[model samples]
Target chain A: MESVGLVPVLCVSVVLFVTGVAGVLTRKNALIVFMSVELMLNAVNLSFVAFARQNGEADGMIYAVFVMAVAAAEAAVGLAMVILLFRNRVTVKLDDLDIMKG
Target chain B: MPTFNDLWLASPALLLFFGAMAIMLGEAIVRPASKTGFWALALGTLAGSAALTVVIFLGPSADAFGGMLRVDQFGLFAQLVCTLAALLTVLFSDDYLRALNLRVGEYYSLVLFGVCGMGLMCLANDLMMVFVALEVMSISMYVLCALKRGDPRSVEAGFKYFILGAFSSGLMLYGISFLYGATGTTSLPGIGGFFMGQHQGTQATLVAIGGALLIVGFGFKVASVPFHMWAPDVYQGAPISVTSLMSAGVKAASFAAFARFVYGVIGTHSAGFVGVLWWMAAATMVVGNLGALAQRDLKRMLAYSSIAHAGYLLMALVAASTGNASNNPALASLLFYLLAYTFMNAGAFIVLAAFTRDGQDYTDIDSLAGLGKRHPWLAAGLSLCLLSMAGIPPTMGFVGKFYLFSAAIQSGQVPLAMIGALSAAAGVYYYLRPMVWMYMKEGHTEARVAPVAFTALAICGFALLAFGLVPGPMLGLAQTSLQSLIPYTIPTH
Candidate 1:
């Protein structure tokens, strides 16, 4: 069990999640933001799998699978929306999509 | 082995899922000339599910599907409220969609699908089930928000909701992973048992962090302060019917699961976490009310009001957390408030939908001027709903607020209750402005009303008045529904 510790796996997950959150906050392109969201989800999946391995339980692994399925479904719908927006507004930049404001 | 009993236990959500598929197939094959057929089918399905939920509530409470879902009175109550909200959305959507020239077969199907997700959420006993159910509901809503493809605002609303929703889900998943690492289980009951047996352990900090992250995810869904930036824009941009569903059904479902997680699993382990919620409740009330005060668009105003209402609900959670085991008045109050919010808020949106004529919503406050003189019924209906929203006397909203604030005080959360009361007082100003414009001011009288929408408004107003005048029966129901939750509460061992 000492080949790789749970602490290192968790640390890597945290770094990936932080990077993904940073990308989401800083990226202007809608597609890039969407990809970053996926990255965050994957980071979560890694942690879930790692914990599942450490505990020798299938529950976390099963949850990680469900998360992947949901992520895929979300991406499909999100990309469709981005395409629709591009068709109507001729742009995919987050800043340019603001038509309604206070 | 999974048996017929499991299917029977999950009949409400199952019925909605099957109904959604039926609508999709019927739309593809039959291709009804008018949307009336689809609307009737959708409403019938929701009504059936609600009836089934009541039946389940009457029979017995049991855990089904290997403990993934729990069929209890509490869950059934939430399911009933969600179905009722969806039924009302369908009733009001018929005319609004026709007026907007956005009639499509997929709308009814998506509503059914969304309600199905909500129903599942009400019954989820495991974290994985909760995550899946939430995604199902949110994805359907994103599509529903963008159904009006030609409207730029609708597209933008859908996009923004999708991005933020996905990001929040990621946060929640990370938290769940941490929780699994700490407790070595994903079942709420298992986690509760683990926490009950162990106190101030090495994993305490991890569990606490996981709980906080879970709150953040739920905060986003419920539109609480600091995570509520998307609400006003999305609410203003989406079709009014969809907004009604979001405010009523989605909020109810999220709160049901959230309350279950906090009270059942976290229990007294939430001591440090309660401080975070206390401040969140206070800030949510202040920010939501202050934000609404500056809004000219009625939809945006209502969105902010919804955020403020979430704050009051959060206060109920705070009170419940501190209360004793014998009777959970705060939980009852939260359930009752969700029901009251469903009727009043959806009714107001129906009134706003009534003003649409040619695919555009005339929801600006100025457009409502002279409405009382021109359309007395419409104006009166909106006034009743708005008054309820303001928590005025002789309305359900008033009773709901009374219960919530009193519960907080009972739990010794007097300061939190005070913050809520103050924000609500400020909220009254914006709620009354619409009534003032409707009755006192005189302007263009071009607003049009649909018969169905008006009927919805009348029903909502009646409910608000009836429930407000005598809240005993509904309060009793809310109390009874909470009985099943007592066993799940984790006790420090």
Candidate 2:
């Protein structure tokens, strides 16, 4: 409470997280869903930065970098899989593919 | 002997890595469709890894990379079991894959990667190492489960596994954060020591919540009760070969970490933690056996059976409760049971693998009909396996169950022990139903396509029988493994 300027940073990060979660929940497009995941990562990054500033520790910054690395790796694999999925099924509409029901 | 610590800890990984490379390279040297050579080399690697693990058992437990990784008797024994599991699985896969016309060179490679992951998990002492190793194991397994991509069910299994696995990982990471926040460190004993100091503080609330969430993550991995919804679908869809590996190799490695986490890290601080775990263990036992009872599909039945066994293991874990400095019979029972459990479960899956033939997998209880008449040996092997799983006398499973219950009783956890015993007794009905189908059915069914590979794994099942009857060496091994918790008490053991 005493280190007063952190409120705006926390609020923005929380908003970013909510928006990302909403986009992932509502979006039907695969690309947009992926974008939402990315958005969530960015929100995490923002929070990490804010925490880094507040805690005056370098760990949060290092964690943000690691998260970015993981995101990149995930993107590479996810995009490859998406391409494979599209090739297997003619269309990419998320709802159109119902071939394998649990 | 290289002081027992030189490079033996990582030799298993190295052997598999080199073996994979050698196999892939050997593909060009061999005639097309010559599957025997690839598997031989793969087995050679696993055997070498197993031997290395034995050598590592001698002495000089080393903490590689400043204790992030510990190579001790506990990890060594776990890796040995994992390697042996992979080896047995490959034996079964040889015939099964051929039957499905799905024999590919990548099978050995994927199996290697899975073993690699399991070994890393066994070795990991740090939280980050555990996560990384888990991902490595899981990613390899995801691909392996859907190796038969032509089958829609296989692909679905892969997707479901990946999604749920990632979800669990995220939950685990979140839990780890709270643990870190509460303890101010990620080292297992550091957290343990931290909890020791702050057993009754403001952090108590966070610690309980975090510990419970962590349990949820682990519960999923072990396929215990509530998080068990995935096992049946995934097990049924996966090629029988992969399922064998998943049931054996994956289970052993997961339990290794489970013991370390519960016994070493969190158990030291609070009674409430162990109390929560006790209920989780109880729920897992009851739900698992009941779920298995309704399954007609052999794979699905075994899947649920696996959950029940996981519950049994949880009993060992419950008995093993480490926070107090009491002599825990539970941990000892867990050790014996895991050894027994591995042999019986892996053997049963082998019989299932044996029955997979001519581009079709036989999984229905009816498929096993007249098996005794059709193929006496295969029927006998499978019957032994099932009987063992049902906790019948003179089998490894019985000893395991007996040890577990006796431990619970000795510990004064009698009601818990009784529940496990009753649930196990109920388990005998479904387990015996398979036997009746294999024996009493009148119709003629085709004999399983007898394969030498499957024969070897069936031999593993018989080995369990021998161990069960005598149990001297195996019990000695288990006790030795249990005794060598040197890494836990001394970081530089």
Candidate 3:
């Protein structure tokens, strides 16, 4: 099998991460914000897998699996919270959920 | 080969995890209308975990689960602190939950699960383990915060916390991947070993960037300044018991893992990181205290107080990283302060939870007016907690702060200590306001107290006084726990 270069892979991962961070900071829709978080996690997984392949070690791959599992759990909880928030406030906008602001 | 000894070493976390599962299964099968049974079961699990922690503490320390976890005094002591906080939360929660009509079987199970995650965090020896354990703890907490389903505030708190928590976790995972790439290993000790050896230029840069990201991640967890925007909102919005648990258990567990990573893995190898922590500590203290002064809500005030306390604890981290690694007084003081914080901060929340009934929380500082006349015991208990939080004499907070500031000074970080002292002084006004409201202000009296919550408050107040008066034992315990980390002599001067 042919080998993929490392710098390009890392560069893509960094782009994905920055995009995710921007989405999270800029987006108002709760679902979109959560999707952004997922994107960031996926970016992390990409880097982990790339590192694992580059080093020819299983550790990074194992970590990637763990991160995926955590991301899944986070998604479950996040969706549940979104449903709850929508039920309580009839809106899923982050700005509208500011009843407890200082 | 892995042996039974490894299981024994991980027994505390294992017990809590199994206990959490058992409660979930039992709730499913039995479908009990009241959560009393689940409460008892949760308490039993925490007690069992605490017992296992003591046993592990008394026994020899060892690596378990292929070095993913370690059984050492440092981790065990943190486990003990977490278990104690969980136990108290369970003890204080039953009536509060019932009062709020939020009692559910899942609450106890989630608390148990959260403690399990905390225990694992304390013992985590690998970056993967830390990430997994942190998620386990945080996910459970996110759910618990929103467990008051109909409350808009609770739902908001949960949503906000989940978003921020997940975002930070992603950042941390990316950082961990970088560290893994640089060191070619995810193990904490391996990372340390790799860093100790001369590194290539790219590897060194990766480690530096990775370390910076790691700080950002933990910085969120500990609610340091610039990352503390979520704390007051979350604390005020969650149920009081959950808030108490978050402030005490979550903070302690995160600090435990953070300390291990900084001291055990990175040691004093990176002066740049120490400088970053120094600035973080100073800024956190100033910002947390200054932000707290504008709060009228008791919970929000306490939230800011917790942030300021995080600042003080971060100072200990700064001292540990900047000065000697092992036998560092600052490190011991960190443990001491966490223990002290667990009691007093949680106790204050218990007092607030005491007044809550029928899904309504009277958390305004003004509502506490005339409580001194109506409920003397409740008033006294809360007063002691508040005084302790204010770092008054004959309180655990005082001793903890004394040790922390002294250690900072001993390490020649006098300016940092001075900033901490000044901010802490500014903090005293808000901490004392509740007491003034209870005693002096003339307002209506409609306060009620729950038996279990009162008992929890009494325990916290007693610990505050006892530890403050005779800090020798807890101090010794904190000092002894530091032996498992890097070794260094306390400076004679």
Candidate 4:
């Protein structure tokens, strides 16, 4: 535990965030994309915690908590939207959800 | 601990919050026979909120909840615009909702909730508050966009918005985290102080990256080019009423926050950012105007127009960053233009909403043919709105564009202003195309002009012309409203 520093944690957070972004960009499944968004948010939370520890302030940790709460609310809403899409079109594929275009 | 003063200062947001809760509860309990009661409640709540915002705007600037919220004239003015946008949206929504077979009490509550979020976003002084308020606004909009769940287009629009909006929020949060690492605080003024005080090393890099990410987040929200793919789709898919509120209210709130963030954090230290914003402004203007010319659907065309308007407003931010706070008129121009946009954009959408027939929206440009003959009053009102959007003289949009471009030139951004002017010139052709269809072409159609919606459109068109003719008082108000932000922008000299 003592060996881990802010830089290493931030590196790990960056990796997680990049992976999440890749999942969102490459994946066609809506639910998987939703989960990727959550991963990105969690990565943000990790960075915030590490930064708070480095700064010796409680603000970043509290912000991480706020992020968690917001992410939860977002998850509830995102899942509901996905379900609505499924019910309306019987598929949650991003490619299939193209009833509107130029 | 929060005192009574804090609660009073935050009353506008609290009013909308309680109003939304009451409507939601009323929906579950009474399940009212008509949506009139909910509509009235929403209107009264927005009116009360607007009134409170005006009162605060007139009073001295103050902060609430230990500076998490700033009740300054700038914030109050933005809140007033947002509340007005929500009010006008509700005014035309009841009849349109019934016309489209979307009779639900939740619509009013969600709009109120969304306005509540918008109000908070305008006043938010802390990054955490901004994030929470943004989500509150976006989540409500996501639900509102999908309100017509039976329509696959509507559902798909909501889903796409959710995906992209969430992605941007995540990026913004990560940026905030990096900024916290650099400065050890999330307060705008604190971050400003950190930058102004000599700083060096990896912190500068962090600040640069964080600021870029923040711009990306806001760019997505305001629907600037390169991040604007979802806007036309969402606007064309969602109910017209929702699209109106989204364009006017959401854009106003986001710009308000963006202005504060840029001024507070970067201020005169925006040497690197001005070039980025310059290219963005030029590209957005050309793309949005060119896109609109190709669109045959009125809704999609307006969506593109809204994107172009965002580019114009972004030019104002660029100008503000180039000059000192006391001399710059960019922020004031941004505020004034946002107000003008709210009226004209909302009025145009209400006109579109009025044209629904046989349970479908007639959004095709051809559907407007011969409207000048059959419905002269409605046609005239829409023409006023459209002409204002095209920046013709004696309209508020023209006044706004003049102030914005003059500010850019004053800041030595001549090429940017020229690009804006040329794109705006290109925009006029499409803005007039609809009028040609309305008056010059021949067809027969009857538009159901609800009295409430007509009254709202009349108010909007009247405000545009009246203010355009006498823009002195309103422009003065916009100029004075920006004074409060100066304290947060520490001098880099």
Q: Which candidate has the highest lDDT of all?
A: 4
Question: Stretches of candidate 1 above 4 Å error?
Answer: A1-3, B199-202, B487-493
Residue-level lDDT of model 4, residues A29-91, one tens digit each, is 999999999999999999999999998889888999999999999999999999999999889
Q: Write the per-residue lDDT of candidate 2 for residues B196-228, one digit (tens) a residue.
A: 563656467657766776788788898887888
Best prediction by TM-score:
4
Off by over 4 Å in 3: B487-493
Each model's lDDT: 0.89, 0.73, 0.89, 0.90
Docking quality band of candidate 1, CAPRI definitions = high
- Over A1-102, each residue of candidate 3 has an lDDT whose tens digit, in order, gives 977798889999999999999999999999999999999999999999999889998878888888888888888889988999988999999989889977
Q: What is the TM-score of chain A in candidate 1?
A: 0.95
Residue B74, candidate 1: C-alpha displacement in angstroms: 1.2
Of 1 and 2, which scores higher on DockQ? 1
DockQ, per model, reads 0.88, 0.23, 0.91, 0.92
lDDT of 3 by residue, B1-493 (tens): 7689988888888898898999899888998899898898899888988998898899878889888887789888988898898888889898889889886898988999999999999889888899989988999999999999999999999999999999998888889999988878888888877766677788988998898999999999999988889999999999999999999999999999999888866667778888999999999999989988999999999999999999999999988877755467988999999999999988888889877877899899888999999888988988998888889999999999999999999888889999999999998998888889999988886777777777888899999999999999999988998888752122111
Native contacts present in each candidate (fraction): 0.88, 0.01, 0.94, 0.94
